[model samples]
Structure formats: C-alpha cells, structure tokens
Target: MSNLVEFNETSAPGFVLLGFTERAELRLLCFFVFFTIYAVTLAGNLGVVVLIRLDLGLHTPMYFFLSHLSLLDICYSSTIIPQALWSLVVAKPGISFPGCVTQLFSFATCATTECYILAAMAYDRFVAICNPLLYSVLMSQRLCVGLVAGAYLAGVISSTIHTVAIFHLPFCRSKKIDHFFCDGPPLLALSCSDTHLSELVVSALVGFNVLSTTAFIVTSYSRVLAAVFRMRSPPASRKTFSTCASHLVSITLYYGSSLFMYLRPSSRHSLEDDKVVSMLYSVAIPMLNPLIYSLRNADMKRAMRKARGRVLSLATRGSQAPERRGGPLHG
Candidate 1:
C-alpha cells in the first residue's frame, strides 16, 4: 500500500534492490557460487566456535577472543549472505522498508562489534607478548567478559543511532537501492529528504570507529613487534610473530576493504565498486577466517584431529555395542 501510494505525505514502503544486472544468464551461476560461499562461511565459522568450546586446552584468552570473533563472523555473514543469495536466485529482489532497516541495523551491529572485538584481540596478543608477567592478571576472566560486553553494547548503540537516523528520513519518490545489501550510503541515496545530517552522523561514526580500532590494533602490534625483536632466540621470535600473522592478515584484509568502501568521499561513490569491496568483508573474509586460523595454528589442528578421532571412536563403539547385543551371546 505504501509503495503504491504516490509522493504525498507517506514514506516509501519498500525498496527495489538492483543487484548484479550485468548478465541475466549468469544469475543462476552467481546463485550457486554464492550459495557455496555462504555454506562454507557458516561451516567454517561454526567449526571454530565448536573447536573452541570442545577443546579445554583452548581456554586461554587468545582462543577465548577467537571464539568470540568466530561467533561474530557467523553473525556478520548471516546478516548479508542470505539476502544476497536470495537476490541472486529470485527474479524480483525487493526489500520492504522495515526489512531494509532491520538489515541495516543487523549489519551495522555486527560490523561495529567486529571492529571492537578485533581491537580486543589485538590487546590480548599485546599483553601475552609484551607483558607476559602481568598477562594473566591484566586480561583476567572478568576483564575479558567486560570487554566482550562492551563491544556488544557499543555495537548496539551505534547501530541504533544509524537506524533511527535512516528511518527518520522521508522517502517519497525513489525506492531503488543501487547495491546488493542495506548499507548506509545506498540507503541515504534513496531518501527524498536532505541527507546532510545522516551523512554527517555516518561520517563521524565511521571515522571514530575505524580510526580508534585501527589505532588500537596498530599500537598493540607495534608493541608486539618490539617485544618480539627483543627476544634472544631467533626461532622464538619467529614463532611469536607467527602466532599473530594470520590474525594480522585477516585484519588487514577486512579493514582495508571496509575503509576503502566507507571512508571515501561521496563524490567518488560507485555502486559497482562498493559491491565488490563489500564482498571482501561480508563474504570472503568469513570463509577465510577458519582456514587462516586453523591452517596456520598447530594447536587448532591438533585439537581438530583429536576431536575428529574421538567422534569416530565413539561412533564405532556405538555401532559395535548394538551389534554385540544383537549377536550370539558369549559362553
């Protein structure tokens, strides 16, 4: 009804997402490709969560933060990938106003939460490497929990503000979103009303979140590098750096794409380029997280192997027990 109404007093009810309109023939191929990506993202991140939970040896602060990161990755990918996959498969890729707002809130919350979580992880590594004597006391269980809670709280607060700002805008005419997902910029572009306030708020929040988190990560790693260099043994230094290499790589990929997409001037906005950059963070990064962490870390591999072995042994015993009960009894 709202969508049918002309530009009068009511806001637009829904948005038509112009997703990947290059080649109609390639839609199905895109669908299956992204479907596989979504599946892998879910499986990989979920595996990390399970590994962290089942392996008691991974109860340290590093793994603790890693489990949280894995959970965030799952949440992060879920906010976008399902809709993206559906858009690829479905003919009419439309999202209601409320649906778009909800997606934006969810995406923003997850993204902001990830930024804070990554910073917390960097701090964890900093303490472990730089201040080994005070590491346990500094990154205590209570403190870690508090840090995690703070991350979620910050995410919620920021997302709520952005959602409110976007929803308050009047959208009477254009209802087409130029991108695949409900991001701040594309949504702002669709609003009939002046978006100066919305743009300002987004810019301020984006700068604060990105700059602060980047600063924390940079400072942490700088100290980590210093500490590693001071170590006497070359192998020990290499090992110390190796522990953080995967995380650093992931951070670079995520933040690099994110910053390039969001922090750029609006004059340079290109929907096509934005979608490509978003894929780096929304899709590819989630799929790569588990691979990077598990493949690079020896402990995770051992835990995974042990877990697999246990599961198989249990399954074998279960089947044999039933067979033995059903078979001829011993004398």
Candidate 2:
C-alpha cells in the first residue's frame, strides 16, 4: 500500500479540507447558514456562562457544571466553525500539518471533557433527588472543582494519545480531506499506512469514553427516576421531571450523533453522512444548549428576566444621563 510509504520529508505536508459543498452557489449558501449558526452559538453559550456567574441563585453545583459545558461548547465550536467558514469562501482551503494537529487536539479535548462533565452533572442530579439531605454536603465546592479538573485532565490525555497516534502515520495519499473539519476517521482513510492499529485505538478510546459516561448517566437517572416516582407531591414531581428533561434531550443529541460518527469502522464510513452528523453535535447542539436549559429551567428563566431588566434599566439611565449633562452644568 502506498500509505505504507512513511512521511520522511523534513518539511510537513499541507492538507485541503473539502468543505460541505463544491458548487459555487451552494458554497455561498452554506457559508451564510454556518456563519449564522456560529454567531448564535457564541452568543448563546457566552450568555449562559455569564448568567451563571452573575446570578447568585445559580451558584449551585448544577449551574457550575452547566457553565463549564457552555464554555466547552464555545471552545469546540470556535475551533471548527471559523476554519470551516473560511474553507467555504476560499478556492482552496488548506491547513498545514501542524494546524491540522492543533485543530484535532483542541476539538477532541473539548469533546472528551464535555462527556465527563455531563456525567458529573448526572451525579449532581442523583444526589439532589435521591439524597436531598446530603446534596449540599456531597456536592461540595471541593468535589465540584475536583470533578472539573479531572475532566480536563482526561481530555488532555485522550486527545494527546489520539493526536500523536494518527499524525505519526504516513500520509502518502491525497492530502484533501473529505469533510469540513479534521476528524479522525476521515484522516485515517487518507493515510497510506495500515490504519488497523489507529482505528482500534480510536474506537476503543471513544467507546470507553462514551459508554462509561453514558452508563454512569443512565444509572444516575435511573435512581433519580425511582425517587421521582416515589414523590407523593404532584408539584414536586412535575418540577423534577422538568429539570431532568432538558438534560435528557441534550444527552440524546450529543451522545447519539457522536456514537454514530465515531463507533463505526473506518471502511464503512460515508464522509457525506458523517459531515451532517458532525454538524448536529459540533454546531447545532452548542447553539441549542443555552436554549434547552434557559427555556426549560425556571431558575435560568428567572435569572434571564432579571438580567434583561438590569440591562434595560442601565440603558434608560445612560440615555437620561446624557440629556441631563447637555441641558445644564452640574454644580
């Protein structure tokens, strides 16, 4: 196989990412669509983070985890969308070997980190619902911080292994990637070397990461469900159901798309199909997470109202201040 030809050039090769569409008009349309999505993603995720920080009511472990998830969504979306938008406009959208490595590493890190954070959030809900008396004590500030730190560390480790493993392979074939972003399966397909080992490694890592966290979330929610069922108070049951619903939707969207994209063998991958699925998790979900939480959770909605009121009040005061300054000199 030509892929067996090791990349021995002192200088690294550059790669062109073939974005979603090839036709000139379609590219234009895609550019506008994705740009809007990216803009909304940034505004929404940042708003969530800021809302959590400024609102004292949102200082709980649940909000803390939510804030971090928003940050991660911002991060990974930023890594891919700008480059993808660029690819859509330019004649040849090329990324150097180093740039590709960086993109992959950053994306993988954010994605892996998000999985564990979601799991942590599930545990938080578990404690809140099942062991209400110990909720505060169990999900202490120390434990919350520790969980977040661990998630980040796990991301770094997982990303490092995958990045190093894939990039080390020889790329004697075409440098044009079929998808908009530098994903693993597509990259492996371009490799001149035998990708069995890399595929196994990637699949194993993804399976472990996805399944383990998913199992944890499932178990946590199972207990939560039992507890919810046992509640005799109708209002309390309704409130708890509403709280869990948002998270369940988020988990389904992210994990389902991710599992489909990564779990398959490389040879069976349809690059065209993969691109659409990638958009679901990497682009759409980030933009939707803020909406999911804010629209569903009463606390978040209340905080948003307060924040909006504050903004309006500040704007009104600012508008009046200029008029007063113009009308008369202050003593």
Candidate 3:
C-alpha cells in the first residue's frame, strides 16, 4: 500500500469535472440557473445569520443552531456552486489533484458538521418541548458551545479520514469525473485500485453518522410529539407542531437524497441521476432552508418585518437629514 501510494502520488493525476453537459444550448441557461440559486442561497443564509445575531428575541439555543445551520449552508454552496458554474463556461474544465482534495475536504467537512448540528438541534427541540421547565438549565450556553464544538470536531475527523482514504488510492488513467465536484461516489469510480475497503470504511462512517443522527432526531421528536399530545392548550399544540414541522421537512430532504446517493454502490449510480441528486442536495437545499424556516415560523416573519422596518426607518432619517443639512444649514 505504501509503495502503491508513492506511485499514484508521483503521477499527480488531475480530474475533469463535467457539469451538466446535456445540451450545449442549455449551458448558458444552466449557468444562469446555478448562479441564481447560489445568489439566493447566499442572501437567505446570510440574512438568517444576521437576523439571528441582531435580534435579541432569537438568542435562544434553537436560533443558535439555526444560525450555524445557515452558516453551514453558505459553506456548502461555496464548495460546489462556483466551480460548477465555471465548468459550464470553461473549455476544458479540470481541477488539479490538490484542488480536488481541497474541494472534497471542504464539502465533506460542511456536510458532516451539518449532520451532527441537526441532531443537536433535535435534542434542543426535544428538551424545549418535552421538558420546558428544565430546558433552560439543560441547554445552557456552555452545553450549546460543547455541542457545536463536537459537531465541528466530528466534521474534521470525517473529512480527514475520507480525504486520505480516497486520495491514497491509485488513480491510474481515468482522471475525468463524470459529475460536478469531487464527491466520494465519482472519485471512487475513477480509482483504479480496489475500492472495496474504501467503500466499506465510507459506508461505516457515513452510515454511523446518518443512523446515529437520524435515530436521535426520531427519538427526540417521538418524545416531543407524545408530550405535545398530552398538552391541553390549543395554542401550545400549534406552536409545538410548527416548530417540529420545519425540521422534519429539512431532515427529510437532506437525509433522503443523501442516503439515496451515498448509501448505494458506485456501480448502481447513474451519472445523470447522480448529478441531479447532487445538485438538489448541495445547491437547492441551502436556498430552501431559510425559506422553510422563515415562511413556516411566525417569529421569523416578525423578525424579518422588524429588520425591514429598521432599514426603512434608517433610510427615511438619512434622506431627511441630507435634505435638512443641504437646504437650511448650507444656506
């Protein structure tokens, strides 16, 4: 294995990221589409983070996780979208070995981090709903920081392992990756070496991540629902349902698509289908996260309105101040 690594590393193979080459006419269309999605994703996620920070009303554990989730969305899109848009326009779109490794590491890190973060959020929600009284003490600032730190550490560990595993393998002749980005599926497909071990390792790692987080989410939500059902107040029931609904939708979209894409054999993955799914999870989901949270939740809408009003008020005052200074003071 050591000798083989030397040979593969010495060759310094590159990869070509062929992004959505179905129709030449549609390249421009796809470019614009991806551009629009990336733009919206940036605006929405950043807006969420900014709103959470500026608004004291949202200084709870839930909003802390949400702000981090938005930050993760921003990182997620940045990893894949720009290069994808570039691929559409460039004549021979290829990334060097180092560049591909960097891309893989960043993508994996963000994804793995998000998985744990979501789970942490589920636990937060659980405590909030199931044990409203102890929620404050249970989800203290110290514990929140620890959970977030643990998520990041998990991401780093996962990314480091996968990146080393994939790159260590011997990539002989084939350098052209069928889909966009240096995803595990496509990268493994390109490897000339036996990927059985890599696949098993990845499966175990990703499966553990997916299963553990999912199990926690399921357990937490189950308890939450049970607690909500026993509640006598109608408004309380409605509030609890709304809070969980957004998370359920988010988890479903991300986990469902990702499980389908990654938890399968590389041979079973069709290039076209893989590309579409990748775009759906990596590109579309980020743009949707903010909308899912803001549109579904009343508090978010209120914050947005308040934020907008503040901006408008500032603009109004600025305009009046300029007028007053120019008209009376200068004269």
lDDT of each: 0.86, 0.92, 0.88
Using TM-score as the yardstick, the better of models 1 and 3 is 3
> Model 2, range 123-205, lDDT digits (tens) per residue?
99999999999988999999999999999999999999989889999987888889999989889989998899988898888
lDDT of 1 by residue, 1-331 (tens): 1222133213436777767763656766777878899899899989999888989999998898899889988988888888887776655467777898899999889888999999999999999998899999999999999999999999999999978888899876677777888888887787788888888888788788988999999999999999999999999998888889988998999899888987888889888898889888888998999999998887898899999999999999998997788777752
In terms of lDDT, which candidate is stronger, 1 or 2?
2
Write the candidate numbers in order of decreasing TM-score. Answer: 2, 3, 1
Worst 10 residues of 2 by lDDT: 1-10
Off by over 4 Å in 3: 1-12, 323-331
lDDT of 3 by residue, 19-67 (tens): 7774667877998999999999999999999999999999999999999
Q: Rank the candidates by lDDT, best first.
A: 2, 3, 1
Look at candidate 3 and give me any clashing residue pairs: none
Quote the positional error of residue 17 for candidate 3 in Å: 1.1
